[model samples]
Target: MRDLQLYASEAQRYPPESVRNHMISNSIVPIARQFNEDMDALRGLLPTQTPCPLPARMAFVRNKKSLEGIIQRLDHRKIAATNIIARYNNGFHLLYLLANLSRLDGFRLHCNILSAADGIKALSVSQDALSQTLSRRHDALEAELQGQKAEVVEGLQYQGSKTSLALASLESRVHSQQQSLDELSSRMSSAVASPDVLGRMVRAELRQQLEPLLHRFADVSLLIDQIALGVSKKASEHSDFKTGGSGAIHGLSNPGSERRVIYTWVTTYRVRGSQDGYFRFRFVFMPRSWLCSTGISLVFSSGPDEFGHYSICPSILPIQIIPYSSPVWDIFERDDAFAVRQLVEHGKLGLRALTEFGQNLLRHAVHDNLPNICRYLLRDSGYGTLFLDDADMSMEIPWSLIADRSVEDDIESTREILQLLRAYSDSGDDSGNQSEWGWNNIFCSPCLSFEQKKSYGHLFLEFGATLRLFSWIRNDDMELNKSLLNFYLDTGGDPNQFAKTGIPPLLFALLLLSRGDIEPDISLVTILISAGADIYYIHDPDNDPDTARTTTDWAFALEVEDLWEAALEECGLDIASVYAESDRRLQDHRRLRGATRSGVDVESITEPGPSSELRRRAGQAGRRCEEGWIAE
Candidate 1:
């Protein structure tokens, strides 16, 4: 009704006398009807005496008259929710009633109060209450309470029997097992620890434990003769073999063996504070023909000494030896073999381009760290061709690239590959998106320039990118959101984007959410989360009185609180629910980052796989980047 009045006012149109009279009638009559309907609904739900009090009665008369005047005047100012609420002393009651009705009807009433006077705020709720609700995390508390109840009940039931027997048995069994477990644990620990008394103790125990089996074996020469006989018997099983073909010996059949000889050479490098960190070489199995055609498998380690190097250990076969440096020569010896003939028949060009790019940046020219680069690249090169931007300062081979091993260790190359495919590559075709903006267009590249020639410095550019990302996400610009998300993960996009901008992604996300513009995207949220963006907890430090050193600032926290409450009021969502979700995400990411920093195993880090939806958005962004325009 207030919206109607506002529209009338904005349109500069007042209803005719007949229309005004009708509106006046409806305004006065509708409230009374609403009051009666509400009272009827709550009669059974609340105390019977909770009707309009004396003060409320007087205010209700004023409210009644104001509604009538609003229709007669056809003025927007007189018909907003606030004036009506103020006119009626029971404004909160009216609001509460309307809120209940709206919820029951499954409709949203963005107006502050369903009144016929005074401008209605889009949302309502005292700021403090909102903050408490967002911060309290009520759901977690409820779950905790429920868990406690279950645990307490279990404890009571198990106290006398389960608890007692478990305790009694634990100590008894622990005493027996402790000696062996502790010794074994220590002995195993010694292998990774120091090599002295403890190490010798472990080695002696392991070797002595296995040596007795060797003594039970038959005489060496007699056993060899028997093994040879077994090898010949096994070779004779092949239909192609003659009755005595097992004795051909050129193929070197051993005692009960069907073994093929393989030899590989591996090399390793050193790591800081560690003995092993090296690259390795392996001879992967290929057909004999492939071996002659240079179809050899070549594997190299990206880092230092890795696990599982080549070794020759014959169990029950006669082995042939070739020159260690020339494993290829050994394959050439089988040129006349059937496997070699098959390779010549099929693929003359046996091996695909085989170059161990290794730590060489040139060979691995794809700088997966540049989503902005792809954006920039698409500007010049067709979207079908994602060009690598040399201008990206971060991509330039840094002195620290080789010098900073610690930083390098933290980088996951596979993640980069995944991010690149996610951000730049089009799913439908192998080609990238087409170019729309120019090669040097600033806006085309989503990333801030690290080069000094750009208007904003590197840090500010990063900061702006963060803001744009938040804005896009908030607007539910899925394409932009996806690209920004990819940018964040792939480029390690600016964590401190808000550092200079004075506005973080969390706050923006909350603000947009409050405005009822968009819902949250957890993927983008996850990226910000990993980068230390938290809505609930702000890193505010206090200033020292003596030194005047500022420890932290809680301004962000206050802003978040204000925005959160406003959002709750706007969205009509449970304030506690939103807050709990925020805290859970924030705390989880903080813990995740902490774990990574504390040297937790790489395997432990949960990999967020490619979101198919995200890929779709990226594909769209790629197309959008090709067709440049203002993002609505």
Candidate 2:
């Protein structure tokens, strides 16, 4: 026992250096070697400067895999080293020095591991950034092409119209010349003194007049042919131009070039024609968030297939484009803050709305989970607050979409999202406006009935979510709403407060029992009374005919039971008048239900309303006196 105790006890004497050195060599040296290898590999993977677009896809993928492998391997090493340093004890005085050295080495390893992780993130952001750039270029080029195409179609129509008008004028001149010739022939025939001489005079005059007119007609026909040929040549040139046409407009011909056809004209060219068709410009991307709509889409449309209607379309361009060249979702998934920041800094993905506010890459972040990327976007990115874009689906917003969602972080991340919003609340936004994104209305969504929804509701309270609660129950939760109800009461929700809805605390409780019925849970009623609910509760929706129908309006009609009245009396308030009025209304079921019409007869005959088609057909067939009336 003494030998065992001595072995376990702390040794005051210094252990020999040789023994400690062997232990360190066996354990710590391998870890140090691995740390160096990982660091070297990571440094090699992340380039010193950001690639403009990105390297070839396969090369990028290879580097990405290498960086990720280093990160994972180093993470495992970090954890193993931490455990070793924590529990290391050989009970030798000299080994303390070794443990301390190992401790310092572990710190260095951790730092290297973090550095390697960041490189992985940069690689990802670069990839996403490149993809986004190419997509934007494609859209921009297509828009320019469409604009140029519209101009061509319009120019051709205008030139064709001028040609047609000239042809009409030439034909009119020919008809007038023929009329003059015929009239002269008639007069000559009537006034002739010599038949052979007169006949020769008429023939000579007709041929002379008709010759130049025919030539003029032939000239107009030739001009029409040239115009048609020009159109065909322009079409072939268009095919080639598009292949190399990235952003080059006006590739057709220089306006001042003498090479222009003597017959060609572009002086009156206007986009889509002044009187041509109009377009309702639409975007081609799925808007990603309320604070952003950064989608890369080509919302193409085919307009009226007529000449003047050939409106020139202009493609939309971004103001502050997202510059991330790679997909960095891996960074978000890891929740690595440093790596996320690297991506943000390197990619320059700040407050960019491809068009305007309430459209960005935020939806992508939330779709995965709450991560450091969201933090940079909401707090660090200078975006201020992510305002709700009404144009998007409600699921795009954090409050409505997340806590009730089936994400990995579940309720915890959902709360963090709300807290993030709280930190970035817009001072310019009106918190009192319950219909929008703010305190008064922190998403009373149907999705609020989620598992953690009751817990999620408390986040709103922490963030200063106000409730009119006529004194209680703010959560959409069925069971845990009691806590929220009390939260409202404790936080100064007025139990007797009546508003336009006319639902006081007392009647409001009864409405909670079910959808159109007024059955109050006694326990809940007592709780309301403790919170200072009015026992009388006189003025409700029942008093105002103009009031919109509400659940309280339905509840007040269910006759107040003697038990309820007695309970109120015990609380030192009389609801006798309320009971009597409710009883009177309840006696007449129709009156109690607030039936819109006085009679159930639908319309009371009203001088025999229009007959049903079936009934009309029956009457027409009525005892048809064997008449063909039935057949007719």
Each candidate's root-mean-square deviation in Å? 43.6, 36.1
Give the TM-score (vs. native) of candidate 1.
0.16
Candidate 1 residue 231 Cα shift, in angstroms, is 85
Summed backbone clashes in each candidate are 26, 23
Q: Give the alpha-carbon lDDT of every model.
A: 0.34, 0.44
TM-score of each: 0.16, 0.32
Q: What is the lDDT of residue 389 in candidate 1?
A: 19
Off by over 4 Å in 1: 1-444, 447-560, 575-632
Tens-place lDDT digits, model 2, residues 62-88: 666676687788667666655554455
Q: Where is model 2 more than 4 Å wrong at Cα?
A: 1-359, 363-371, 379-424, 427-459, 468-481, 497-502, 514-520, 535-556, 559-572, 575-632
Q: Among these predicted structures, which one has the highest lDDT?
A: 2
Model 2 scores what on Cα lDDT? 0.44
